[model samples]
Target chain A: MKIRTLALATAAGVALATALPVAASAQDAIYVPLFTYRTGAFAGSGIPIANGMSDYLNMLNERDGGIGGVKLLIEECETGYDTKKGVECYEQVKGKNPVITSPYSTGITLQLIPKAAVDKIPMLSMAYGLSASADGNIFPWIFNPPATYWDGASVFIKHVADKEGGLDKLKGKKIGLIHLDAPFGKEPITLLEKLAKDYGFELKLYPVAAAEMQNQSALWLGVRRDRPDWIYLQGWGAMNPTAVKEAAKVNFPMEKLVGVWWAGGDDDARAGADQAKGYKSLSFHAAGAEFPVIKDIQKFVVEKGKSQVDKAKVGENLYNRGVYNSMLIAEAIRNAQKITGKKAVTGEDVRRGMESLEISEARLKELGMEGFAAPVKISCSDHNGHHKVYVASWDGQKWTKGSDWMEPMKDKVRPLLEEAAKDYADKNAGWPKRTEACDKAS
Target chain B: MDILYKIFIDPFMQMGAAPDLLVQALWEGLVGGVLYALIALGFVLIFKASGVFNFAQGIMMVFAALTLVGLYEWMARHGVPAPAAIALVLTIGVMYVLAVSIEKFVLRPLVNQPDIILFMATFGLTFVLVGLGELIFGGEPKQMITEQLWLPKGSIDMKILGGLVSLQKIDIAAAVIASAMVAGLAVFFQSTRIGRALRAVADDHQAALSVGISLNQIWVIVWFTAGIVALATGIMWGARSDVSFALEIIALKALPVLILGGFTSIPGAIVGGLIIGVGEKLGEFYWGPLLGGGIESWLAYFIALAFLLFRPQGLFGEKIIERI
Candidate 1:
């Protein structure tokens, strides 16, 4: 009976394996493999992001007949944000000739960075990657556009400084950074400490363990004890809601607790309802579905039942961030095709395309994304383009623009970036020198 | 000298300087400890009954909570009243079905298997439940039906120790409910016939089987009991924060609680949880900064290890027959 069962199982496995590729090859399109986390601790944040990417790409196929007359075929591989599964997904998808890989995880991005150099596939870690990856000289194929963590740290400081009257007013002020204990959470620490030291503000850190995202009473107790003037949260997923709830629980001034762009989901602030009214989060893209591009997405993708996203979630902060991320992917593909003069370009071509992206205000207008996203321009020498961010405050109903586009303290940030980039290159030994890409103009 | 002063003298001085904050920390610790105890109670119930280290208990908590919330949401969307939705989900025998399915497929097939194999079987069960739960629930964090469930919202601000201590009413509700459940469990385990059979089977499976105690029936009852504990835990925890699978990681804290409690003792689980939670809170709050902060993750394990070194059988664990 065992032998008979084994024979049947083996036959079935072989049959299924052989049938999958045959089905996949039938779709002649530019395959974009999305390493998405639709389920996990981080799924609350990831679901809308993944939906935006899928819906936008699906919209391109539905509305514009795909970018450059070629259909955009996205094969989503669920990562659940686990590094091991993310790596598995990368390996599984890389062989399928994907134009570019957007690793949503920092740990996964770290693994894929060295591999991206070897595989010659252009990787986009948009808004979140190694702060030093912005130095495109040592890292050629890797890209983290719009902003880096160091930029975010500086931006947070700028806002704090603004709130405190001036930079000199930041002196003797205590700033608490309540963060998740992970690579992504730790990205802002080195920069924040440097800023604190320079600005003469006392910096206190309360790191939440990944396992204890939901259970953070002690962390809040520390937050209460320290009683910093400002609390900056570097948390994601269920952590955000819990942190907000805990803040509300402890009577921490909701307006003073600022979150990074990743922490600014509509659902996050809603966790504390009326109390979370004055809560604020950093945002690069404008929130809400008023943009023409969003309406196009709604009419083309979500409304037609072509996309898995709900009609109500078409223009949420994270959803819009997802839409913006997908917009970047689409623009990169268009740029790659424009540069290579091929309808469907290779990963190498996409690398060059990413290095020389000219996403000006006018181009955004042309793409129906003028007010939706910040105008970013990427060059080989500087991968982090146009580091402008706006603060959005929740008013118990919706997130409104609380601040104008505030550029980071570049003079304070650049020297640190250069040093970190040099240090990274020194550690890696024989890191790739940007000889050709840096010389070219978009 | 300064470092030593900062590490040892500073924390105590700080504690003395602000007695109100200290009281606040202790209250937070007590709340945290209760939640931990609830999770560990589920583990203790299963371990005491079946010796099959159920690794899927965390995911089970998530699944049960997700089901309740998902059903409630679905019902609300369909214009059904919250109580009717609550009644339908609560009365649907979800826990019974889960217990029976687990016993039949997971336990019955692997009966008399090595203890490690049964433990590994639970890991398989974890994966299955995680996939199945995610498939059903769609992975977005859901706010617990606090109002519909009649759970209190907002907090009570008490002025003492020269400052205010804010305690959530829901946390008070949780403490009351958890204590009641623990008390109820003690009675069920002590006097009930099925509970006696469960204890006998827990003593020795073969010996109990020879004495006409059906292992299958006992397994279902125990698992069903664990499921109920999980539900109670889920409601409390989900009320505290949004419900998501990420909350499962908090369940791992129960491991140390179980280790300290000796897995087989109900009261031990509670005591162990309180100790670990309080200890973790105090350590993280006071000594955390000196050690670069975030010591709450390992403090519980270290505490358990220190205790285990003195009492390897755990605080209330029975001595092994072999050791005897």
Candidate 2:
């Protein structure tokens, strides 16, 4: 009798705790649930990024009194970079009727893609996710703005092209792709392979198993033998630092090696110290906490001791990237409020706002993030704004800008994107078609 | 004909073409084997005394390393000289506390339990340690203080078989220290009084108990000893890569070593680890391309599986001379 009573009470308690967030939704607030990861294997990079997202939102509340008088309600559900936990967080927060869900993991973003359409929630995976999700027509509810992996891949090739003096010089150039043997790492392979064939370069592939990330002597040995002229690193977490260290050990030219944005972390390069100097990585936004918006965050959120961020490390690369991500979301919310003339907008309204987003230089100045990121303009058919990506080299101290904005091989990547998106839509069996809403938003 | 040649002859041709690469592969395998052997040694020590599989050994390694680094860094920040001493002491002290708590909270209550239950208990213990370690040390990967610990750094290049092979000085140090630890442990086990008692417990817990051996005491000692081994393994491996929970996954590589080297035999663990390590690297280097270049993920298990099919008892496992 006592056991039965205890069981009943426990179940009731769980139900109430689960339902509390759903019931506590405020009519005066725009709820944006951030499916953030502050722990687990990739927490080295995840913590700063998540803090940036949280701090920027908190900054708006303190500095601007929220977007258009409706206080922003940012809820973070820790995913620990796990897909199952990400989905669970999504289900738990979906009932709260969030304006958006920015799942920072590619795996979580992929899982939430179909659910976003069904749940009518816009899933924002900034710069990482299935590159095919960039086709806004099929994945109307999904948004990966600024650039996609395919776009990044093309941009890398173009940067290489400019460095080598001409595109034709890539002929017979041996380029090695050292990637994590996972879906996220494999995202750029198809585009890279096609480019290799077109450019007449020999593409040697090296896939690092997750467990073998730190123990990559064999792979680097192969790199030595193959002697790829350029190495494109597509790695994350412990893999990034280990790869940089291994490259250093093998006397691989750090300047000739470039990493994707995910691999270009301050901690990653710092792991190798002076040896990692001259290591290059792609960046969609300028790094560091020197922007005016960051000062506002320091003055308000961080200085007030409201945020979990270490105040000293506020202006780091991943943290700045996080600030850039929140800027995108906040601007979209403001856009949504203006479009619908509703301060407390729903997920669908925010989706529209994202579609109509045109982050111009004037708006950036107004936001106090003048050069944080490129001007991101989204449309109905194209989800990723596909902005120019620049190279940032870690010169032992900090990441310094290496190049002017290099345009992606859009002439090459766009056709592939359309075909892949179609393939994805067809493969999924009756993917949702773009409604008249898309035409109106554009 | 193309497929046959690619499978059978091509790898050998490549090996001939780059004998230096083969030597490099062998050296890498040898180093990895040593690390795996160290982790396997922890398993053997606990299993030999208590008959518990102890799935928490991997997490134990992470916790040990984290405690060492965390305290070391904290002390260094506070102007402590030779922080490595403080780090080592704190790590061992934490391990002792862990062993005591584990024995008191987990092992004691479940004493005389079935082996499977003890295995399951270790699984629970894995989660407990992971949560505790993360709570204490946050989940950031920290660089091992090689200079503080006086472990070697940088690399040395030597020409072998018409190619250059560069080895990190740290790895050479790891190999030397691991071999020394193994040799020292062998001497202790063979000669020590407590070692005799531990062996008696391994043979029969009931008999050992009847003969006046304190089961609880032996367990604590074995666990503490394993803790020291874990700390050593953590430092060595962390010197190669950053110390993080991710090392826990690499620790799983010790399982096949356990399989190949029998569960109870100390010598078996060392031999088995080397074999699996060498086998996996060779397979990944030569045959990996045929299987999408990631046979390292499963090749160790596959090698162990095939070996088990025929040997049943591992390479160094003793055949019972006469069944009671």
Candidate 3:
């Protein structure tokens, strides 16, 4: 009787041990902390991105039962587009073990990068962040998935060259850059300067004061006086349409004006669509209704009456692009879960997953977004995996692809990137050391 | 000589070259000026009736706009039709009841205090309104209830001397509404009993008190009317851009407008608004190059400053002879 009792006790202990893993797995939720600005000057962009992020998470739960059966939980903290507030939010939410954070503002991303390494959290900046973060080995915690500003500048210059027949034909031509007087606007300058030197073109710089972009008489006067052959706008908010309108006021050819991706949106065109006809902008992904992903969003999100925006805004350029951004982040999280057998993934796990991600053609096609973006293959050396970009032009109503995907001139950009990164590191003093491989390359 | 050219000759030359652009700039300035006047009108109404410069007028604009949008959104969420949803939004009129209570409880006891103290109290009220508005409405910029309100859209494009001068349909509506409101206010002050009481209070508080007019009652009526004016300005301006805290800054623009148009004169506010509007627009268009553009920001203030140098009492402000 004593032997039988001891054997039953051992079996009960085994049963308890087996149930522990199940309980642990059951409580596992992939927490994604969102730093958003729902109130501020830039809320127009921030609101949509926040809604898209939340809606996609909801879609994951409803459609696929979350990533690998571990439900995704998102906690939002409003940043009001302020960097200091963003840091505070980061500190507050970092304890939750967020897999990754996407602070949509470049200013916020810059502030959070140091904290990212300290907290062991990954920051996934799809497009807006430090350009030098393209060297993922140096910035292991930061991941710029698709492209960088350097890549954007090169693509823009290439488009201009192609328009003028060839790169050699760019010599003796003047390309003016009208940018906001902020870090966000200054991103492409070093790259463009290098490109101008290599391609033998004159580069003119025009800076617009922040919050005062609506008024641009002096800038246009400069435009009229200088007569630059091409205008590249690195502007945001009201600056885009204001520039277009001012250009029209000065009788400058609208076809010659180009803007960065930030300026390419429905609202930007809405104000001065007729005058802004033929205004080209650099885009990393497909713009307009051609993408199947857009159709699916309109069907699944808008048609089902689950959208945060009006049905009319569903297929709009910026709104749909926001949806694509949500899908990308979701895909990265899923990929991370698959690699790490743990049902609950941590920030470090997400970082590894982001570096090793390969969004191939088949995956895109399955997700109904085939040909919308180039196949992104991120690695330790390259954080901005796909440096492919196309030029889209506004034809009064909608955006149309004006050129095929073009690669930036890396030969011109690499040295500049290294210099800027070294300068930044020297100033900061406590920045993480770059790997020997990057050092050797530099 | 170059400085003289930059200050005067160059600006005129540019204006001559870009007459069309100048006209467009003037049009934008005029619209901005009118909005500023609307905000100033709210301030003047309360100041006239209660002798208190309500600093909370800006937040009132934001609060009214937010309430309108929040109510509409809530109605939509409940599957209410657009027309009924709008009617539901009009129920934000209930805020006036709260306003009246605050006057009775908060301000009535502190009556006869110095104007500066009263101003500080209103400043406190500003913060309270901001906090309460954000707490209730979630501190986000919501689309204005323009469609439900049935406001006009697009602009009327006119050609003048080979130049296109486009004015928004809503701007015209704003001008008309503002004119009618001012006219109604003038007639009220000249014709109505309560309006005369308000004017008497503005003229002399103690003397008006001796005439058996209940100052508290006059204050309530004035505050409510000011709230209505704020709501009107909020809707008009919100329809233009959006309903958010950013609209609050629109009220600050009225400070310069108040300075240019005498604080006491209603017609001065209107004419001053138009002058500042037209002047700043033309200044930005023609003279902006000399100052690196964006002159509209400082143009009105500088104009007011220069005008004050010439006419210290403002365009129609009564001169007060100091005994000191």
Top candidate on DockQ is 1
C-alpha lDDT of all candidate models, in order: 0.86, 0.87, 0.75
User: Model 2, range B96-132, lDDT digits (tens) per residue?
Assistant: 9989888888888987888899999999999988888
Off by over 4 Å in 1: A1-28, A439-441, B84-92
lDDT tens per residue, model 1, A7-90: 999999998997676446334568788889998889999999999888888888999899899887788999989999999999
Model 3 pairs in collision: none
Better of 1 and 3 by TM-score: 1
Which stretches in model 2 have alpha-carbon errors above 4 Å? Answer: A1-21, A439-442, B318-324
CA displacement after TM-score superposition, residue B13 of candidate 2 (Å): 1.9
Report per-prediction Cα RMSD to one decimal: 2.8, 2.1, 8.3
Q: Could you give candidate 3's per-residue lDDT for residues B1-324 as a string of tens digits?
A: 998888878877866776765666666667667767788888888877777778989888888878877887777789877743564347456557757976897689888888898899998888888778867885545556665777776667778756666666777788888878988988988899988999998888788899988887888788878887888888887665456666676677777777888777777777778787777767755666566555666787999888899878778777889898
Candidate 1 lDDT score at position A47: 93
TM-score-wise, the better of 1 and 2 is 2
Question: What interface-residue Cα RMSD does candidate 1 give after superposition?
Answer: 1.0
Assess the local accuracy of residue A210 in candidate 1 as a C-alpha lDDT between 0 and 100: 89
- Sorted on lDDT, best first, the list reads 2, 1, 3
> How much is the lDDT of residue A307 in candidate 2?
94
**What is the Cα root-mean-square deviation between model 2 and the actual structure?**
2.1
Tell me, by lDDT, which candidate is best: 2
User: Chain A structural similarity (TM-score) per candidate?
Assistant: 0.94, 0.95, 0.88
Predicted structure with the largest TM-score when compared to the true one: 2
